[model samples]
Target: MLRYLRQIEVIGVENQKKLSNSSVLVIGAGGLGSAVITYLACAGVGKIGVSDGDLVEIHNLDRQFIHAGKIGIKKSKSAEMFIKTLNPEVEIEIYDDFGKDKSLRISKYDLVVCCVDTIEDRHKINEVCFKNKKPMIHAAISGFEGELAVFDFRNSGSPCYECIYPRNIHSEKNSVVSPIAGIVGSMQALEAIKLICNFETLNHLLRMDFRYMEFIKISISKRKDCPVCSKNL
Candidate 1:
């Protein structure tokens, strides 16, 4: 409680407790995962599950600060060690894989934060969260550009990840300016905190283009004939 005193002053003790009682799953351990995992732990999220199948590489050092010293370690384990040092009050679980079948476990948490880059994996996460009626925060970055959206499956009517980015659409190769990952990941953590505190966030697509230093929000809607979330309707 002492560590969270300043934050409690702004969000109130009730919201602080809410954060302390929530569980969130972060599915990535790279740039976006580093920031998301760090802030979520410091915010005192009660339980955090980190899943990643990659090992820390030399290149990952640019943005994945959580694995600063251990270059050969698994990302999930590295993140777990950082959380233990950063905030022992927060409990953590580590998963070494992010398979489509493994996505079912996402239902066990209050929220899921998608820090992965592949469209296929995003669709898999969206499917599981929608099926289990859990809200999710989605973030992606590429070349000083990033986008974020909240799929409030808890609402049952909000558009899903697939709704905004169709499966057939091919995304360009992943290329990111290191700082953009931090920017987008921090936004994901902030939005997750807001969600836990019962606050509303952008329901539409929020895009950031650092090259032009411009931000944009575009309204989005669920596809009535779509396959993913329409079944829930």
Candidate 2:
């Protein structure tokens, strides 16, 4: 309680307790995952499950600060070490290979944060979250551009990632201006905290172009033919 004294003043004791009791699964250990994991752990989230199979490379250090001095090791393990060092009171789980059974893994946590880099991975996460009726915080970054949205699958009408960007649409470029990842990733963490504390979260896609300092909030609607979420409706 003393550790979160300042935060408690803002969110109140009950909300702080909610954060302490909540569990979150962050499914990437790259740039976005770094910020998401760091903030959530610092905020005293009860349990954090980090699932990333990739190895930490020197290039990743530019954005994935949690993996600092941890090259040549799996990102999940590195993240676990960082969280333990930052806040041992917060429980940590490491998943080196989450591809085996996403549904089983996702079902164990209260909320899912999709920090993975690729569009394909996002769709897979979206499908599984919708199936489990779990809330998901999704964000993506490329160069100076980034976007974020929350799909509360617990609500039947919530629009999912697929509803906004269909499977046919693909993006493989990983180029990103480093600070952009930090900015957007921090927002994802805030959104996750808000969702856990039962506060209002972003219901629309927030697109930002840092190079131009422009932000756009686009309303999202469920696609009647959305293969992931609409079927459930």
Best by TM-score: 2
In candidate 2, stretches whose alpha carbon ends up further than 4 angstroms from where it belongs are none
lDDT of 2 by residue, 1-233 (tens): 99999999999999999999999999999999999999999999999999999999999999999999998999999999999999999999899876688889999999999999989889889999999999999999998899999999899889899989998777577999998888999999999999999999999999999999999999999999988777745
The models' CA-based lDDT, in order, is 0.90, 0.93
Candidate number with greatest lDDT: 2
Model 1 misplaced regions, further than 4 Å: 99-104
Residue-level lDDT of model 1, residues 1-233, one tens digit each, is 99999899999999999999999999998899999998999988999999998999999998999999999999899999999999999999989987556546786789999999788888988888888888889998998789999999888678998888788787665778888899899999999999999998878899999999999999989899779989646
Instruction: Work out the TM-score per prediction.
Output: 0.97, 0.98
